[model samples]
Target: MKKPLLMIVGAIAVLAAAAFLYPNAPSGNAAPPGKDAKHGEKGHDEGHGAEGVVEMTDAKVAAAGIEIVTAAPATLHDSIILNGILQPNQEALVQVTPRFPGVVREIKKRIGDSVEKGELLAKIESNQSLSVYEMRAPFSGTVIDRQISLGEYASEQKPAFVVADISTVWVDLSVYRRDLPRVRLGDAILIDVGDGGDPIKAELSYVSPVGSADTQSALVRAVVANDGMRLRTGLFVSARLILSAKQVPVAVKGSALQTVENRNVVFVRSGEKFEARDVEIGSRDSENIEIVFGVMDGDKYAARNSFVVKAELGKGEASHDH
Candidate 1:
């Protein structure tokens, strides 16, 4: 009887120690973290973690003309800029050559002289025909180069003069391999003729599949009308390759975007507070930029006067620096 009583006392002591170490949980449940203290609400939970949030008074927002726009689906236009040089039209540039081995007996046109179609250019004494015949201009153009002199012997293989029609020209552009996927025939391109004038409009006529041996770039050719002879051969020019419009799910006005701390950000309105939210950007045009990620639809963001948010953020940084 004494041994059984000692064993029961030891069991009671162990139970008392276990209950002291691990107590039972409370009967009622606890509320989750970050919930509203009064009503346990979640309406203000979204976008709470964004940093650089600036709160403005109603008067200040109105005085600054801060307009808020909602992010929505829109169309985006993309473009690529290119560089090129103007060249003489290859189809119109021709070498005036003799049909037979001959000696030039008479010459009419000189370098820089203009000639009309079927106009007499020179007279040659043909060696094969044993007779003198007249050589006339093949087309109405200017004599750009001259190799034959008066009474000079010329052969069928040698050209006497080079003629070219300068009213039209070709713009040969360099399309890199990275840009080749977007470039196509029939695409419209604007050529900056570099004369303090408006850009010339032209259609992309050709693209060589093979890359150039010297530049390792594919050649894109466009034909441009050279009225008043403004576009000359060998003149360097810039090209803007216009792309088609594409609709996207999210886009914003370019005026709303600002760079903050090395990150592209847009100020989103949460109640009276404007939070600068980091964003990822995609294709863009002059007016609108496509947002690839960050910020959701129906989220109001500062459009015009977004610089005011940037200024406020700057003030906060300045204060922290002090």
Candidate 2:
């Protein structure tokens, strides 16, 4: 009887100790020993919850009328950019010089003065070949340069007045030798005057046969009409040369194209994910650009604001590494 009683008392003490140490312990979700209680399973559950919150915020922004465009097949016109200088047409520039040596009796027109054809520019008293010589304007235009004043000596070798017709001006543009084969006479061109206005239209009048030895560039001359006398000679202008007329596939905006690793690329939307794809580019217009390859027609692409997508992709990659 004494042994039985001792065994019962020891059993009761062990049970009481266990209950004090592990009060409120989980029954079915007990963790194994020597293992982390919160590992992949716990992390995945929290990560998915955070992702759900971010998705909801993004959906709200899209519903606010923010414009988004997808890639589509469209026509694009090709163009080439070239540096140009404005100059007076040969037929419009006139130099006033005396036939013989003489003393200038009077100077009529000053610089920046407008004159007409056959208008008198100055009067000179002949000293070498004749007497009382009168200098007249060669054409109707503005006096761009006047080097002689009253009582100044004039000669046949020196110009007294330089006049220019601003109705039509010539723009000398430089084109790369590699592109010279595509450029030809009579091609339409556009000149940006840099005056915050509409560009002037012109046509290619001449193409140089030889390229510059140093720059390896060929000279191309275009004639632009200055109907309103808005364009002035000696003003720096930018020229755009039309290269081809064939219609090729292009994007709606040029900003859609991005440069990656020294190559052109664009982000393509592939079923809730964006993939960066290298592309072959050909031509570009004022607003759109031609896409050569690495994309298919009707493919969904980030037309504008693609930097956001890139940032998200980078974050995901970083998280995976961490």
Candidate 3:
């Protein structure tokens, strides 16, 4: 009986020594605190917290095409938007006519043909003189219309060709009666040809004194130099007539603004991370917006593609929750 008792006491002492050596060892099927079988050293919510911080490396940011810019004073344009269509500069257009009533002998120019000044367009047989007369282009331009076909009559009463030098174009904008009071000649305007390109800048050259009885709108025009022939005649366009410009102390591009967690936020750059900072926005133009709060001058932020940061933050939060 004593031998058996001594053996039980020895067993109890060995178990106590093992427990002291491995005090924090994981129990069966259980992971240690702040760790899991899948999570390894840290739990799912280890790195994220209430204050939103998105960890993005420089390479990741560059790969995402996120442009960073410092908040600074910027001009906010207060402008009126107007829709219009492009037209050829009527002043630079010409109508070519035959000098005498004649029968067409040879037709050379066609619609859409480019012509040089004094270029021969056709040879005509005059009805009275029975002599061949030459029809020449009055100026260098493109033939927008050709009235006579081969062997067709070249009449003196009708134009033989409609040529226009489209080196410059007129943007014909219709101003509603209500907006006409605000628009004036010589005001600065931006012409958008809806080709996803930069808007062309020009001054308003003319404003009609009379309003159209049919549309109750007045015609306003801007002459724009057709650089690269980008402003095609008959293409629909939009214009922003500058009404006023105000300088704000702190402003950012409108693309930087984003709505996150039911609040407006701008992703501000911190070392190796971006924080979704709440912001109050004020006046905004087509390109930029005034930052009234939560951002300060000299703060570097995601000026473009800020939605990428917002998406990353959402993903982080979701992973933390899961």
My TM-score estimates for the predictions, one after another, are 0.55, 0.64, 0.78
Cα lDDT tens digits for candidate 3, 150-207: 7877798999989999999999999999988888789999888888999899999999
Order by TM-score, highest first: 3, 2, 1
User: Which ranges of candidate 3 are over 4 A from the true structure?
Assistant: 1-45, 62-65, 315-322
Instruction: Using TM-score, give the best candidate's number.
Output: 3
Instruction: List clashing residue pairs in candidate 3.
Output: none
Q: Using lDDT as the measure, which candidate wins?
A: 3
Q: What's the lDDT of the predicted structure labeled candidate 2?
A: 0.74
lDDT, model 1, position 113? 89
What is the clash count for each candidate, in the order shown? 0, 1, 0
* Preferred candidate (lDDT higher): 2 or 3: 3
Query: What is the per-residue lDDT of model 1 for residues 59-127, given as tens digits with 9 covering 90 to 100?
Result: 788899987899998877677888999888989988989988789999999988889999999989999
Point out where model 2 deviates above 4 Å: 1-74, 128-131, 245-250, 257-322
In model 2, the clashing pairs are 117-140
